[model samples]
Target: MATITSAAPAATSDDRFFMRMAIVIAFTIVAGFALNFAMGRSTIAARPLVHVHGLVFMGWVILFLTQVRLATGGSLAQHRRLGRIAAGWVCVLVVMGLAITVDVTMRGGTPFFFLPQHFLIANPMTMLCFVALTTAAIRMRRRSDWHKRLNLCATISIIGPGVGRLLPLPLMVPYSFDIVIFVSLLFPAAGMIHDWRQSGQVHRAWVWGALAIFLIVPTSQIIARSPVGDMIYAAVTQGHPGEKVPGLEFPPSPMPE
Candidate 1:
């Protein structure tokens, strides 16, 4: 299987910069399937929430790539200006994330490929991690080293849904969600090794950020099947959507044409 990795021993600045770009570009390509869905390729219609979610996610991709280009070109003034805008936009992303998670679960858009409660829990956890890491990155903006690494950590956090969609992650596998999570780890794993190789130590930003991103997996598995999970599932998904969509079993969806 092919793999993604960060800089090797004594890699140049250009190498590190392009590695970061590759990470985001890879995510964008994986998630590009959403465009198909939007164009009527998928049965799921593009409702308001779905449209907003797509816009927000796509906006972040553009902002991330553009910011990387700006920083690499020494356009610090322009980058900071856009960074401020991106920071505010990050808040929108988080709010929309939470809203869509609840909305999807409530409406039974939680895929047949996932345990409903776990889906709800894991989906929002990514945003929580994103908000924390991105906020930390912004606070440490003057410390360019920490800022850059943490920003990488934060941007990669949202790659989970993309990875899950691209991979053939059916609900049948006993560890399907785990598989999605493990594939997603390639992002931070690359960053972790990059940090270690470059500085002879893993940056604490990557350490903490990777912890935040990775921990949600086991935590969801643990929490979503517990009493807490029952209450959460019971509360958010009610009546029709809840009954129509079983929490643990796969439901029929439109087969591809």
Candidate 2:
């Protein structure tokens, strides 16, 4: 009988890469909270929607870290199994994100750093895009290259919120969308670099995915100004009768002396 040949050992260098990525993620979260505290942003006061959004987002961060740990531990089978749960969790996150975005915008209590007009329009769109990209990534899981790139794209698309907190709001306010564009570009750039190093050619999926996300800012802005956005804003705001639409006015402190 012919001798059977064993496959060569796969590269296991993802440990260092994942550890570095985890550090960056942890730093972003810490810096986000620190900046919010320093700026006295009112998100900490915690409306119901805000609480739910926070919990969902924090859970995502935890889940991401856990996934990285499991993958690095060579628990590929377990990681794939847990990914189903993570996929469900992502849907919940998107729902809570939309709920919070609508709740804050309608109440006219949008985050202080963001332009209320832009925030009202852009936030929900961001969440929707995130869900779409994440779902696409899940769908392509059997294709490792596609799965990795799409997941990176999804993560990069959502990094704006955390990056925004790191920026000085006063400086960023006039160029909020520009900041988002710049930060959002990093994912594709990273992908290009990875491709150049690994395969000597940039992946078309990363190129297209990044471009799509880049276009969304202007698209969302136009949509926000359109009658459709106005009508949706009106409908949600109408739920609270007699209170002025908050986006039309400056935010008020919810606490009283």
- Top lDDT prediction, candidate number: 1
Clashes of 2: 1
Across residues 1-257, which tens digit of lDDT does each residue of candidate 2 receive? Answer: 22222211222433545445655765676678667778787456766667777778888877777776676665889889989899999889888877877676667666555556567678777877788788888888887667756776776677777777776655465566667667768757765776676557888778867976887788787876778767766777776631374443334434453
- What candidate 2 gets wrong by more than 4 Å, as runs, is 1-19, 42-45, 239-257
Q: Which ten residues in a row have the lowest lDDT in candidate 2?
A: 1-10
Error of 2 at 176 (Å): 0.8
Per-model TM values vs. the true structure = 0.83, 0.82
Error of 1 at 25 (Å): 4.1
Instruction: Name the TM-score of candidate 2.
Output: 0.82
- Candidate 1, 48-161: lDDT as tens digits: 788888778878878887787677655889999999899999999899889988998888877766778788887777787789899999999998777777887787777766
- Please identify model 1 stretches exceeding 4 Å from their true place: 1-45, 252-257
Model 2 score (lDDT): 0.69
